[model samples]
Target: MKKFLSLILALTMLLSLVAVSANAEDITLDVIIAQYGPNTQEWFLGKGMDGSNFVEKFEAANPGIKLNLEVVSWNDLYTVVSTRISNNNAPDILNIDVFADYANEGLLMPVQDYCPEELYQDFFPSFIDQSVIDGTVWAVPDLASARALFYNVDLLQEAGVEKVPETWAELEDASQAILDAFGGEVYPWGIDMTTDEGQAAFAYYTWGNNGGFVDENGEWVLNSDANVEAIEYAIGLVNKGFTNPNPATQTRYDLQDMFAAGKLAMIIAPNQLPTYVTDKEGNVNLATAGLPHNEGATSSSVGVMDRIMAFKDDAAPDQAARNEAIGKFLTFFYDPENYVGWVSMEGFLPAVNSAVGALVEADPSFQAWLDVLGGAKFYPTTKAEWNDVKQGVIDVEQQALTGGNVKELLDALQAKIAGK
Candidate 1:
C-alpha cells in the first residue's frame, strides 16, 4: 500500500511540471518595429505622460507577455525586415508602409486570418483596398495622412486676400499678389518638389488636371496631355516667383518651419503641421484647408497609410500563440479611446471608422482632416512599379521646372514606362 501511494504522488508531480512548462511557453512574445531616424522610437511610442501611460497599461493588460521592440534606421529597415523574412527569423509583429517591396514579395500574413470581415468593412474602402494583394489582405491599416493647403491666415489677410483660393486660376492670382506684397522678404509658396513629398504634392496637380499614373489596363500613363499641362502649371508657379527659388533643397520639416515663421504665404503639406507650428512658448495658431483644384476638376493629394504585418515562418515555435497575442495587442491598441490618443498625439488620421467619429467628437480642429478624409484617394499600389513611377515623376518634374523641355521629358518618361 505504501509503495502504491508513493507511485501516485510521483506521477502527480510530473504532471504539474509539464503544466508549468506549457504556461511558461505561453507568456512571451516578440514584437519588432522599424525605426526611421533619431528620436523616432519616441515618436512611435507617443509623447510625454500619454506615451508612458499607454505602454504601462498595455503591458499590465497583457501580463507575462514580453514585448521586444527593435528600432532600425529607415535606411536599414528594408534590409533588416527582408533579411529576417528570408531566414524566417521575422518577429511576431512589424510596422510597414503600404507600398513597400515586402508586400510585393508575399512575405506577410493576411489580417483576414485573424480579424473579422465586418470589423474592417466600415473602414474607407479605398484605404482597405490598398492593402489587398493577390486577393489576400496582408496588413491592418494603422494611420493615414492627406495633403492640404497649409496657409498663414494672418499673412493671407495681410496680403488683402479675402478668402482662400478654390481654383487653380485664383491660386495663381493669390500667389502673385502675396509675392508682390511680401517681396523678397517672404516666399509666396514653397513646395518640396524634389523629394517623394514633393512628388506627392505634384500628384494633386496631375489629378486636378485629370491625369493619373496608370490607365484601366495598369500601364503607366504619365506622358498624357493632361499630365503635361499639370506639370506646366506647377512650373508656372515657380516662374512667377511664387515659390521658393531652391525648393529642391528644402526638407518637409524645413518647409514647415518656414511656414510657421510666416515666411511662406501658402504651401501644401500633410494635415499634421499644426502640431509642429507652435509659438516661441509652444503655443499654436496654424490652420489648414483643402488643396485647391482647377475649376471643374477634383482636387487630390498624395495619400500615405501605415500597415501592421505578420510574417510566416514554420520554424518559429508557438506561431499560433504569437498570432493570437498580436491580435489581442492590436485590439487593445486600436480601441476607440486609445486610438484617439494615438492619432491626436501623433498627428495621424485614425484607421478605424469608429475611431474617426470619436476623434471628431473630441477635437474640432480635426474637422478639416475629417473633411479631407471623406474625399481622400490613395496612390497606386499595383506592385514593384511604384519605385519606377516615383523616380519617373521626380525626374520629369525636376526637368520641367528647371527649364528643360517638357515634351522631351515626357517622351523619355513614356519610354521608361513602356520599357518597364
Candidate 2:
C-alpha cells in the first residue's frame, strides 16, 4: 500500500508541472515595432531589457506576461507584414506611422475595446481624433512632434537681422539681406522641395496664411486663395534668388545636414533638429520659434503623431488573454515616469496632455515648441485613400518647385483627392 501511494504522489507532481509549463508557454505576447534601421531599434528600445527598462517593468507588474519584440525597418516592414498576412499570421501589436491603411483593411483592432475608458480619455483629443474613423479608434498614439522655424542665430546676426522673422514680409526681408551678406558663400534658405518634404512645407505655409488642406467643416480647400498666396510667396523667394539654387532636388535630411554645417541660414523643420545641430557642433547658437505667418494670419505648425496598434487574431485560442496583456502593456507604457524616457529618446512632444504639462514645467526650452502646438494641424489622416492623395500632393508640390504652375497643380490635386 505504501509503495502504491508513493507512486501515485509522483505522478500527481508530474501532472502539475506539465500544466504550469503549458500556462507559461501561452503567456508571451508578440510585438513588432517599425524602425528606419537597426540603430533606430537600439535608440528606441534601448540596449536590452533589464530591471530598469519598460519591458522588464511591464513583465514584472503583470506576472506571466512576457513580451516578445520584433523590430522591422521601415523599408522592409510592409513586405514582411504582407507576407505574414498571406500566411494568416500577424503580430499581436505593431507600430505604424499611418494607421488608416491598416484600419481600413480591417487589419487592426480598435484600441478602445481593450484600453480603459479613463486612460483613453487621457490622450490629447487632437491626437486621438486622428486615429478614429467611422466611430472606431484604431490605434493608440505613442509619440508626437510639431514643426518649428529653426535659424542660425550667428548667421542671422551676421546678416544684420535683429530678430527672427515673425511674418511673411519679415522673412522675405531677412532672406534678401542674408543672401546679400553671404552671397556665393552660403544659401539664405535650405528649402526642401523633394516629395518627402514639399507637402509639409506647403502645409505650414498654407496654415500660416490662414489656409489649410481642409476647412473647419472638413471640406477640401487645398486651392483656396490664401493657399495660392502662400505658394506664390514661397516660389517668389526662390525666383528672387533668396533661396537655394535648386530646391526640388534636396530632401529634408540633406537640408538638415547643410543647416547644421552653417551653409544654410533658415528652414522650417521638426523640433528634434536643435539637438542634431548641437550634436554636430554645427551651430551652438541656433534658435527656434513658430514658423512665420502672414501679417494678419495666425501661426500654426504641423503636428505629427505615431501609433502602436493591437491587431485582433481570430486564430488565437485565447483572444481575451491577448487583449488583457495589451491593455496592461499600454497602461504601463503611458505612465508618466515610464513614457518620459521614450518621449525624450525620440525627441518628440508628449502625446499625453498631463505629461506635456509636466514637461513644460521641467524643461524651459521645450515651451516654445509646445506653445506652437496650440493651433497645430494634421493632414487628412482619417481618409482611407490618404496615402494615394498624399503622394499626389507631394508630386504636384515638387513639380511646382521645378516650375509647375502652383494654381493649376493644387486645383488638379484638390479635384483628384475629392474624387471629382
Candidate 3:
C-alpha cells in the first residue's frame, strides 16, 4: 500500500512539471506608445498596417509572443507613466520623448540587452548618441522631426520682401514689411510662448542667437549672454507688434490654424506643416527656408525625436527567452518595409538609415529634409535635469513677457537649476 501511494505522488509531480513547461513557451509584453496623430492608433491596433494591424502581424510572425499595446495621448502620458511606475507596474516597452529619469533610476534595461546588434547598427549614429548616458545606451530613437522657417510665398512677395530671411535683421525687416503691407490684418510672425510649447520657442530663438540650453560639453548655460540677448529680442518682437498677439496664450496649434487660414505670414514649424495645411484645406502657397540666425551665429535646424525603451523585468521565468522576444519585436518594427510606411503615414522623418532610401524614393522632398535633419541640433533631453531646464526656460520666457527682466529671471533660473 505504501509503494502504491508513492507511485501515485510521483506521477502527479510529473504532470505538474509538464504543465509548467507548456506555459513557459508563451510570453506577453505590455507596450505603451505615445500617440503621434489621429493615425497612430489605427496603425498599431486598427487596419492601418497594410490591412493588418501591427499586433496581429507581429503575433502571426512570432507565435510565442503576445502584445498588449496601448496608445496614450501626449497630454496624459507623463502622468500615466508616473502613476504606473509608482505602482511598480511599468510597461515592458515605452515610447516617449524623455528617458534619462528612468535610465538614471536603474529602471531601464540597456539597449544591448535586447536590441539585436544588426538592428542597433542600423540607427543613425547621431540619433543613437542622443540616448546614451555615461557610456550606456538607454533607448533607441523611434522617429524625428526637423524644424525650419515656413513662410507664405505670395504674402512675402506682396509685402515686397525680395528674398527669404536668413538673419534676424532680415526677419525683422520682412516682419515690418508684411505688417505695413497688411496694416496689421495678419500677424507677420507667429510665436508660441504658451506653457505647452514654450520650450520650443526658447529653442527657436536662443539657438538662433548662438545660445542654447547647454554648452559643447553639455553643461547648463541658461543665463548666458547670447541667451539673454535672444530672449530680449523675442520680447522685442512682441513689444514692436511684429509677432502674433497674446503669445503667452497662443499655442502651436493656434498658430498653425492661423497659418492655415492666412492670418499668420511666417512661423517656425516642423516638416509636417504643409501636410497640416493641406489637411486643413488651406490654399496658401508655402515655401521653406532655414531658420534665421544672429548675423554671426550659426543656423541650426531644431530636431525633435522620441525613443523606445525597455523596462527592467527581473521576475520573468526565463530571462533569455524574454530578451529574445523583445529583440524580435524591435526587428519586426524596424524592418524597412514597415518602418517606411509608419514614418510616411505620420509624415515624420525616419530615425534609422535603412528607411531613408525608400522614403526619399517615395517623396523627393524627403531627401532635402533628411539632409537638414542630419545637421540638426537636438535638445539636451538626456540630462537628468532636463525637465527642470525645460520648465525653467519656459518660466523665464513667460516672466520676461510680463515686465520681468530677462537677465534677472534667467539668472535666477540658472541658479535654481545649477543648484539642482
Candidate 4:
C-alpha cells in the first residue's frame, strides 16, 4: 500500500510538469522603446515601431514567443516608465539611458544574471565598465555618439578662415574674423547654451580643458577654475555677438537648424550633425574636428549612449522563460551582420570591435567621428543623485548664461550637488 501511494504521487508530479511545459510554449514580451523621430532609421525589419524585421524572424525561429513593442519619446520616457514601475507593471525590456538610477533603486536586474560572460565581453571595455554600477551590469549599450566640432566649410572660407579652429584662442580669432567679415549679418558660432545642450556643452568644454565635474576621488568640482573659465568663455561669445545672442531661449535643435541654414560657421555637436544638416541639394560642405580646448590642455568630447535593458519580475510565473528569451534576443541583436547595420543606420559608433571593423569597411566617412570617441568623457550619470544634479546644473547654467554671475551660479550648484 505504501509503494502504491508513492507511485501515484510520482505520476501527479509528472503530469504537473507536462502542464507547465505546455503553458510555457506561448510567451509574450512587452517592450518599450524611445522613438528617435522619422529620421531615425530602424535596423530591425518588423511590422511595428521596433523597426527591425528581426522580430518576425525571431518569432518564426521560436514559435512560442512574441515581442510587443511600444514607442515613447525621450521627453515622456521617464514619466511613463516611472508610472509603470510604480504600478508594478513595468515592461519586459526598455530602451533607455537612465539604467544607473533605476538600478540604484532596485528596479533593474543585472544582465550578467541572464546574459553570458562571453556575450558581455563582446562590448567595448569602457562601455561595459560604464554600464556596471555597484558591481552589476545594469544595461547593454545599443549605440553611442561622441561630440565633435562641425564647421561649415563654405562659411569658414567666406570668413577668410583657412582652417578649423583647434584651440580656444584660434576659435576666438576665427569667430571674430567671421563676424567682422559677415558684418555681423550671420552668427559666427552656434554654442548651444540652452537647457537641452548646456550641461553637455559645458562638459565638453570642461573635459577639453582637462577638467571635469568630479575629480579622481569623486569630489564635486562644479566651481573648479577650469569649469568656471569654460562657462565664462561660452557666455563671452554670446556677449561678443559671436554665438546666438538669446541662447537661453534656444535649444540644441534650434542651434542645429541655424547651422543647417548656413547662418553659423561652427557648432559643437554629436556626430549626428551630418545626418541632420543635409538639405534637398544633397549635402553641405561640412568639416569635422575635435572640440576646441584651452591651450596646452588635453582635448575631449562628451559621449552619449542609448542602451537596451531587460527587466525581471519575480512574481511572474514565466520569469525564467522570459529571461531566457531576453538572452536569446540580445545574442541575436549583437550578431556582427545585424549590429553592423544598426551602427550604420543609427548613426553611432560601433560598441564592439567586430562592428567597428565592419563599419570602417562599410563607411569610411565616419573615421573622424570614430577618432573623437577615443577621448570621449562622460558626465557622472552613475550616481543615484545624477538626475537631480543634472537638473540643478542645467538651471544654474541657464541662469549664468542669462547675465547671472558664472562663479555665483556654479558655487550654488556645487553646494547643492555636494549636499545631495
Distance (Å) between predicted and true CA of 164, model 1?
2.3
Model 1 segments more than 4 A misplaced: 1-24, 27-29, 34-56, 71-76, 79-88, 116-122, 216-218, 279-286
Model 4 alpha-carbon drift over 4 Å, by segment = 1-24, 37-52, 279-283
Residues 316-415 of candidate 3 have per-residue lDDT tens digits of 8888888898899899999997889999989999999899999999999999999999989999999999989898888888998889999999999999
Q: Pick the candidate with the highest lDDT.
A: 3
lDDT tens string, model 1, 1-420? 999999999999999999888767653545666553334466445454354655556677887566666656656777887687677687667776744466677666678665555566746677777877677777777788887887887788888888788788989888877877888888877777766456675587888877877766767788888888888888888888888887666767777778777788787887776766763232324566667787888777667787777766566577666667777777776777676766776677877887877787888766777667768767776456776778778877777777888767987888877786
TM-score of 2: 0.87
Instruction: State candidate 4's TM-score.
Output: 0.89
Best by TM-score: 3
Backbone clashes in model 2, listed as residue pairs:
none
lDDT per residue for candidate 4 within 56-76, as digits (tens), equals 767777777787867677888
Q: Give the alpha carbon lDDT tens digit for every residue of 1-420 in model 2.
A: 999999999999999999887876456777877773334466435653232555666777888788887778776787887787778888888877888877888988888778877778888887888889998889988877788888888999999999789999999899888988988687777676676657787787888999977889877887899988898888888888887777778888788888999888988888889877766677547878788999999887888778889887887767777788888878887888777656765677887766776677777767777776656888888877677666776776677777889999988888887875
lDDT of each: 0.72, 0.79, 0.93, 0.78
Clashes of each: 0, 0, 0, 7
RMSD of each: 6.4, 5.4, 5.0, 7.3
Q: What are the TM-scores, per candidate, against the unseen true structure?
A: 0.84, 0.87, 0.94, 0.89
Worst 10 residues of 2 by lDDT: 43-52
